[model samples]
Target: MEEKNMFCFQCEQTAGCTGCTGNTGVCGKKADTAQLQDELTGALIGLARAVDDTSAVSKKTWQTIIEGLFTTITNVSFDNAAIEDMIQKVRAEKDSLVGDCNKCQSPCGRTDEYDMQQLWNADEDIRSLKSLILFGIRGMAAYAYHAYVLNFEDPEVNQFFCEALFRIGYAESMDELLQTVLKVGEINLKCMALLDKANTQTYGTPEPTDVTLTVEKGPFIVVTGHDLKDLQLLLEQTNGKGINIYTHGEMLPAHAYPLLKKFPHLKGNFGTAWQNQQKEFDHIPAPILYTTNCLMPPKSSYIDRVFTTEVVAFPGTVHIDEQKDFTPVIEKALELGGYKEDQTFTGINGGTQVTTGFGHSAILSHADTVIEAVKSGAIRHFFLVAGCDGAKPGRNYYTEFVKQTPSDSIVLTLACGKFRFNDLNLGEIGGLPRLMDMGQCNDAYGAIQVAIALADAFGCSVNELPLSFVLSWYEQKAVCILLTLLHLGIKNIRLGPSLPAFLSPNILNFLVENYGIAPITTPEEDIKVLLKQ
Candidate 1:
């Protein structure tokens, strides 16, 4: 690997509001690791394009491609060795495809890997469009990885990962890149659907459940991020060990799944969102197992207690390998011995508990009553003001926006962003809480299902419904979800904590002109505008 500073603008935390061209990422990724990630991405693209046909890509090749893309995602992996190993696996996969390239009479030049520098220096428009595709598939791979672990796989979603990576390296013009960009959204919709099916089928559909903010006195483990499989395994390993597991961040909604919730020691949720972990986990007598994204650089107070598994890694943190044994996480909880008494914590708004599990099944079960209430004018309009929450000061916009919604309007939410207002007692309409927690970030699928179902009930398209999406994005998953919404032709979305740095003026204008996507203004102003629309 080169010993030079790396350039990466793939995420929200890029340096100086542009790219990270330094020795370390704002998220704490070291310079050498960034180079390896870029190298891995380049090799994967070459492997993807080199195969003469789709069938020529073996199962191992596909696995290598998915694992490679997912690992490069921001805050997902920090181990240079692990990244180096994955890069080698990808290269080995490529070598198998290019076997006897020199001996063959028909030599294909497509086997060559395109340098990532080319895309980085390309015209801003082409760069933005291709970034959307590459980043989208990276996010989608997390969802696909979860489903595959549970034995659910969709061939189309799998195929697109290869195709999009291939295009990212080779697509030359704006027109060619734009096609793959939109298709990222389209395929991700399928990928998220596949994950939804896998989760629901394996764990049973989620139901409404109230999660407490209090931590029980004893040995306890706090699980964070988007992986239910990791959480489930931990629950099993810690079951009879006198330890309790509390969900945090994106893992909060795991409490709703029938199979996961069945664990007696699963207990309740701990912290508000990923952004609060540095404060919440400090001096806490428990281990935080990060299974996926939104891993902030750990603090010294709790650094030793934080263990990462799967794609989530921070250098010097104990990494649980593919064996998935969470013994370290369990042992750390025991060593800390927890609090002397049951600790009562409150949400940011001081509520004692938050409610989740308002997934598609639960919401649609009450669909007729919801439609009746809408017809009777009991509910004025619906606002879907949810996505990834961040540590930025302005992110309080979501809390204020949710608070300012008309009492008659129902607020639907998913992902960590809901933590902003999830603990608030927003009351209810027709027996359903006005602010409904629609599971995790992956449960964006459930939110989509509910939107489509509502549109069907009202004899209109989803865009024609009274619902409006006010989304806050911080990572690649949010990017993929945004693309999925655009692919479905949903319009008038409001995005913020500032628009992505990746979007050039022209690319952003293309979005604004074509889809009516705009950044959030003041909550007071945007709510008034959206309500009128």
Candidate 2:
């Protein structure tokens, strides 16, 4: 391992299903960028230690921690300069908390910055447990950051971020770290709920709406990533500017929010999932604005039109700052002038349109209908097929799995993964679409609400209900959501296309024995096993 320039396995697409240990990662991250990210993480850990050992934490302190964590998420920040700036910000925050610690000669090492290499090279079990805590919070931080952007702050969630980082950097025992790992899940549930409240209260509960796949003529901007506030701001700024706005990747769910979807020029979806961006965005006439993660290193063909905001940063791309002004993106869109004609695009399933919304509120609105339909044996089972999508092979299993679901089952999906089958129009059950898109990755909160409500309505625990979790994970957000499901005591979850490389044999066995967690098999076998058919 010392022979390698860097080691990273945080994402599912790591090299060789192990770790990315080269001059560049499979995600196109250079060794230098990876090194800077590690430095940023270490600095963040140091800042957490400072906050842990100091007085009351400030909002700015939590914001720095959240932004630093979000920046290290896969594909979020590829710019060396941006990462370096974050590292400095974290270090400065630590310095402000533990002032003059550097001047002491008899210094206790309690406030020292952690060396991430130590964690990377620790005992496999310890590393695996800490990885869960680290990666889980990294995902949770994205949610927390989103909520924070909407002026919604939860002190418990903020405090836990520091606690988790302190534990990640210092905790040595596997049991201690494992406890923290589950706590990550526990706290992340709360964090997600905070975010859910912020989004719904601010933007209005999402309602089911059909989104087209066509890119209308004239100037247009393609907004991607998971920030609804950023989307709203862009929508506001671009209003009456004669420019159409379309969503891409995880931002596809933005169409369902009442406040966001009301804009007349908020057009439709532009492309498929984030993994296909390089091809889908190639030579496109519109400028693409990334408000958060899932940003690939743009190809030279469309690099000029790439605009990023918030924690997402790629070198040479135009970035929207805290002011939230999107003039550059608008100007670029106007200059490109979009398609000559309205271009109709189809999803992977060759469908011209896809539907979203169907949040927990929307789905549970017809609670009596769903409960009655279940009692009458009209709905046999429920499958929550959701999570991130990636370019990894064997991901076609999701498409096949959704397609092969029984006609009597309701297949609920969320996040970018739905791009595979959201267009397939699985017909309907009790006037409800068999395939329901429940917004972005963060909408796992809504899914949980739906599951719990169904369990209560049926007079059974969620585990005892006719519900199965067939999840596809690609990055850290998926990690936290899976942890949340485990925290809720849900079991028999089929996870794929591949397990996390960070999971040691011992940790993996623990999950399998206690939680019924297993790698996904073929669609037919898994469907049978899950349904007992």
Candidate 3:
């Protein structure tokens, strides 16, 4: 096969639904940017080998691996310079551990950096399994990094990062790689739980709260992505400065945390999901600070107001560093001067306000009420219509799916996909809202907890309960979450807008035959099929 400028199919919106092999990908990643990311991944694989060889791996080495994986996630880093620097850091970490290997006359190839192209060009099934392990860890790294930012550390989670990367580079057999793939899911479950604990313990468990779509008059900033620690820091710096903060994308759930919402100026939400940001932020009079992934290339009009922090870097955007001082963002908001009058924004469904914060703790607190509702025949079924949102055409399936859910059933949603139908008032079943907004994508762990409690209450397994999972995915974070679900033996999951391009025919069939995972059909048809079960 002839070499291409670049190759990527790790996202749902990959070009032609096969691979993005051109000067740029469908996500606006340039060929040079993609090349640099692959180099960085290669360097990280080397670092993992170094860690495996040496027992003296420091805290910084683990942090480097986590940050490196997070940086390669889709829509996170597009700046070649930032990625180049990250590659250097990864190599430096490896050199620190294995410096003496350079002097050895008979150096083994074990510590050599594995070229990513080899895996990309491997057999189709091997490629599929390896991609699952690589992409799943990329997503899990984001969760681990968030937990680390809150001063939380899990040794098992950290060690698994190196172990998984080593497997990605060295494990060659189908069975060996497949075991590692499932292990990614197993480790990510604990990573997500660590993040959940870090978040709840740091900011208090989320409670149901109503966040408006209105942006009040005067200066304000829009914070997007998944990092609550960055939001907390920005909120602290902006306090008493007369500047309000509005949540966007996955940051919308931050309003449910007790410590964050206590600030009067941590006002309502601003826009819809991340995919809509280019349109929603066009010429808007505020600076947007991106704390993690889901950052689209900015339009020329709004480029100046884009400020990135942590690993979310686009060329030419201002970035906040480790000091966590948000003065630059605060100053940009002040300079924009905001609107002369208040601006009322609604979600895609045109609702003036939306309610969130039904995390696992909040939901489980009323387990008796929920079980009674289920046993008394008041609630017919539960639908978990969640995952990331993208610009792909068929994504409207999620909106239509929720719209068609029977009034007797309840809809539980998370991540940005909820933006599709979260604003619609599904009314209530018993005292619970028919549509419950579980926190962010990481909150899927909470959703699992709720499902288990419900299953235990009815003296049945989760598969036997009247529950369905209809997920729409965009990037690797969704990949990890889906793997987590599959690892738990959950069956009959309907995935859309399209199945992942990375899954080979054999692998896809395996999931279908064993796990009952299938591409979503029309909302009307799927609803009927799920209800009859």
Candidate 1 displacement at residue 134 in angstroms? 0.8
Ranking by lDDT: 3, 2, 1
Off by over 4 Å in 2: 1-4
List, in order, the clash count of every candidate structure: 0, 0, 0
Candidate 2 versus truth, CA RMSD in Å, comes to: 1.4
Each prediction's Cα lDDT score? 0.87, 0.93, 0.93
User: Candidate 2, residues 68-172: lDDT per residue as tens digits?
Assistant: 999999999999999999989998888888889867889887878888999999999999999999999999999999999999989999999999999999889
For residue 506, give model 1's deviation from the true position in Å: 1.2
After TM-score superposition, what is the CA distance of residue 221 in candidate 3 from its true location, in Å? Answer: 0.2
**CA deviation > 4 Å runs, candidate 3:** 1-4
Error of 2 at 515 (Å): 0.5
lDDT of 1 by residue, 2-27 (tens): 57888887776567768889888777
TM values, all candidates: 0.97, 0.99, 0.99
Q: Which ten residues in a row have the lowest lDDT in candidate 1?
A: 50-59
